[model samples]
Target: MSNYVIQADQQLLDALRAHYEGALSDRLPAGALFAVKRPDVVITAYRSGKVLFQGKAAEQEAAKWISGASASNETADHQPSALAAHQLGSLSAIGSDEVGTGDYFGPIVVAAAYVDRPHIAKIAALGVKDSKQLNDEAIKRIAPAIMETVPHAVTVLDNPQYNRWQRSGMPQTKMKALLHNRTLVKLVDAIAPAEPEAIIIDEFLKRDSYFRYLSDEDRIIRERVHCLPKAESVHVSVAAASIIARYVFLEEMEQLSRAVGLLLPKGAGAIVDEAAARIIRARGEEMLETCAKLHFANTKKALAIAKRRK
Candidate 1:
């Protein structure tokens, strides 16, 4: 097992606690705030603002929080490709991205949008950029314009089906790859006889791993494919796709909130856990299967909170 240690402020520690809420272990060491045991790594946080990471993937997980560590170990696939910077954005291309993977209360949404060369400047004029930079209201405002202006396809994997897939041992990465691929295929077919110059996917995995994940799929769209990190910056199509995916995810979350008679927040934060406990108290545990991703660590955390509240 590998070992890594870092000192973090209380704010960072609290953020870590929220991020790892689902992975919380009951067996806390004396003076330790929490311990988390994942398949590849074990993490422990202490009151002194120190965090320890162990196990095979310790460095990989730790790299996320330590800026230089990620830069030093960055893989080629994570870098924006030359072709993407020089040509892909200005050419007719299909750009794909996903949203809601990190949220505990919404469906995973994937979208692919086709933006032709001439329309690039027009799309940019709408302030299309990374979805992370825009609020829900902005996403709502811009997504419909993008839809009206471009040909796109979206896939939404709701919580029940997502839970079922997780229970059956489907990794989230594979699920995303499948969704991106399926949506790309749909968009390609929808715009038949008009072949795109390229297909760019906001890189989640290495290019080889992405193809490996889709190796079992019957229909794989591989021609002119480029996987680049921060793909939205590389092309306007990706930005549009990100906005549309977020818009759809927001719509789904609103509908689910209405169905559950409670406003479901985004992200896996303390608020999410509290909201989940409320649902369990008011609606029962089974209601979560219909509305929340059951496999998230939030499920157990919420159950514990609900039980304690009783």
Candidate 2:
């Protein structure tokens, strides 16, 4: 009943053809809007110029509107998220995400996952969305389910290692880029055997900077890599990736807390000051580097407080 019209120019139609390929309900006419029914069904009208698809099918339809058919199957071996554009008209996809960059404790984590066309509904069924939108328990419950439904990879940069990298001159943003890129590379390699055509990543930086960083790494992504804002909301793979990353971050934080015998709070803030004091008292200041990210101003401030208390 929820009808929408998508105007197809040469480019849009070409994209649609590639996305739908053998799957289109009918050929589209010029200057016609595609009518789509909600929840995963597409109805096509040649005279009216409308298309309807649901779930994975709907995603495929959207993708066609953007990149055209030529690019659709080109990366079929790669997952959808890795595709150059996310608007293709298929269900198979993959996406990547990271967490803990702003936290003064625990590890920085990057996660990636492959969502096949058939599994989009399964993911949505599990209430998969952006990890930030869900609490820790919800993420934990959903993470294993996501893993079961999709192939995934996660990279964790422990606080100590992160500090070492920072001391060696890597900025946090650069470090994040490095971790994300490396995770993506690994994910791509993992999914390449299956031969998906595309992947999408939430844009962390401007287009030029992101491309520059990718170029600097000399790592070529075979599948198309679509970069956009709020990609997690638009792409199921990205959403699944975010949940996995957040789950790992929370789990790691708990482990860090147990290792230090105190709860390590999330983020850099005044409460972190108290936690730092506790860590310094229980462990030595020298040990702080092992347990905390030293680059944070919180580390220096905590050290000063520790000295004052002494």
Candidate 3:
């Protein structure tokens, strides 16, 4: 797919809106004046006097309104870095994000989602946002909606597996990189024969470091991969992935809570330490291997708290 962005005056915006008025769609992106779907392109005009043309025939459609010299066609194949930096939201792409990494309990869940320009409105209508901005109930409600609307894949690294890998000298960042890669690969395969304009991963590490960690892995997917910080805000696909991953993380936490007969608190805070101590008392230290990332400082803190109570 191709993506092009052009600056348009109010007159041109009105003209374009009028031209595609019959094809207009609802649930426009925030600050968007109007959006329309055409056979060859999805056109979105924003309040900032910017018009985006995206899809296989984006260039052709954009050409109709602007001259060859005035048009700023930022095709993915021609200027990969520039395209990723500026117009990621305008392109049809796959985006991946992870959750539960900072939490002391539950597995780390990474999810990848594919979103084209055509589905942006639908995704936005699902109320997708950064998972951090939403609470558990909101995530639970929105996640399924996004799952139904987009092609997405999620990978969960349970506590036992996470602990095993951490003990084997693997860094948490490396584990995240692997999980992100796994979900991206799965989604790409799930949507086989239809390549996206790009693959965007919520930036956890520098681009070089991320791939360097995955260098030993077989079948790594690197083409069109852009690591951007705060990516969930850049594209609806990343936000959808974030919400889904967070929902799964919350569900897993519930299961672990039931298994331990105590609520597993989130984060590596004092509350988590208290909960961990309770788990140790009710079950044993080994129980955490199944439900909590043992390498976190909370482990030591919980142990100290448990010993003090005993």
Per-model root-mean-square deviation over C-alphas:
14.1, 9.6, 11.1
Writing each residue's lDDT as its tens digit, candidate 3 over 1-310 gives 6787878888888889888889998979999999998787899999988889998656445645663223465753432333423366877899999989899999999999999989988898888899999988898888888999899999999999999999999999999999998888899999989999889889887666788899988878888787777888778899999999998888898999999999888888999999999889879999999999898999999999999999
| Rank by lDDT (best first) | 1, 3, 2
Worst 10 residues of 1 by lDDT: 67-76
For model 3, the local distance difference test gives 0.85
Model 1: per-residue Cα lDDT over 1-310, one tens digit each: 5566667677778888898899999999888999998999998888986678877666445644542211222243232222416456678989999999999998999999999998999999999999999998999999999999999999999999999999999999999999999999999999999999889899898666898899899999988787777889878999999999999999999999999999999999999999999999999999999988898899899999999999
Candidate 3 ranges with C-alpha deviation above 4 Å: 1-79, 84-86
Candidate whose lDDT is highest: 1
**Per-model C-alpha lDDT, please?**
0.86, 0.69, 0.85
Worst 10 residues of 2 by lDDT: 69-78
Residue 188 displacement (Å), model 3: 0.5
